[model samples]
Target: MSKALQEDSKARVKVLGSLLHTADISNPMKPWDICAYLADRCLEEFFAQGDQEKELGIPVQMLNDREKVNRCTSQVGFIEFVITPLAEQMVIIFPTLSFLTRNLSLNVELWAELWKNSFDPPTEDYEKLMARVNKVVSRCRAAGPWEEEAPMRQSSAQSLLSGSESVVTEH
Candidate 1:
């Protein structure tokens, strides 16, 4: 229902809309524990919707059906197909946004690892999964937006103080 979703929007407007949409779906780029918590909450909402659909005698959507859906598989598919592709395209528009791609790749790698071991239990113990997740979270935290602040912000500040117009781009 957003104007950005309209097919006839101007190029700049469409790009901005797409950027906003990408950010909305970029929750997986957050710290692992927080990302996992958000994902769990989303699934809970889907399950509730499924329950309502059932009560209304309507068929449940594949993702919303708690009984039939495989959480690990679904999450892996979402990250691989949805988040990764979006982040890749977004980086083209805002080159400094590669951090989004990096964080998303980390999340996808972690999710893919979990998905691969979903059936091969004993090897995928809680400790091992948590260790991998924690590592990714730490790496993501270190590579977050704050990491780029110093050079870019400092350059902009210096340029402003010198009354010079300069643009700083993260390579």
Candidate 2:
């Protein structure tokens, strides 16, 4: 893979790991077990906040095991969900947790900013919300099997966003 593609893949894994860590804490369950749970919760959260279509696209049904979660988004949209287990496992085996953690932190901060700016009441208090999320991430760190040192490539956000519309519409 080209250097840029390789770097992007590494970054995607790190971001995905961070997301799983958040889900694990929010639900306090094994990663596999949390898949449906996170999906449900995200649906509720996104819908309740008036961002269902904009943020989550649509309510896709749960996929059978071995089926990949579908995703799509346009230039004017946002999509959020978990990475696949295969991808998740790959990142967990990567050998640079510190780098991933740093990148995760920056991304989380950016997310918080977006959240703050998106709401009239500023929905969540960024610092407090992040602190709570961080607590879960810390637990994920202690749980071990950290995915570090893996080299991989990631699709562009634009590309990743493209396929989600079908998934969302199917629900």
Candidate 3:
């Protein structure tokens, strides 16, 4: 059973990585749009891989563009239906998701502080970097279940300087 669960998790991670990479290449700076697209793809794959009527608890046919558009527009509705549930699942299957969120949140806050001191007329490179940062921050913030959890404590000052340090310490 544990092996099967591991295999299922591996499959989901592969699918998620594929979806994220596809969205990154195709939609570049639009995080929300990319997330919406991936969510749709996830729903499709989830249904295709399982007994939709029994396993999903929701009708696969109803997961159409119209419904997606409606849900995406309503932040409360989107969180309730998509982000909340996915975050819960991530805690079980992808502990890294929680770690990623914590790191990204810290990065976003750090970047915002840096920007305050470094504020100037935005260069093209700066704008692009900011866009990428924002995308990561938004995704992290939207990773629902981990949002309310206590922020992970940092043990070393070096961890504050390099985000990669946290990943190393975690292992």
Best by TM-score: 1
Error of 3 at 72 (Å): 31
Name the better of 1 and 2 by lDDT. 1
Against the unseen true structure, what C-alpha lDDT does each candidate score? 0.58, 0.36, 0.42
Q: Candidate order by lDDT, highest to lowest?
A: 1, 3, 2
Instruction: Write model 1 residue lDDT over 73-163, tens digit each, in one string.
Output: 5665676557665666666656677677565645545454444444444555645655645544444444434243334334433443453
TM-score computed on alpha carbons, candidate 3: 0.29
- Highest lDDT: which candidate? 1
All models, RMSD in angstroms: 14.5, 15.1, 16.1
Ten residues in a row with the worst lDDT in model 1? 162-171
- Candidate 2, poorest ten consecutive residues by summed lDDT: 71-80
Residues 19-83, model 2: lDDT tens digits? 57644543212221232234445545544454433356664344321123221111001211232
Backbone clash tally for model 3? 0
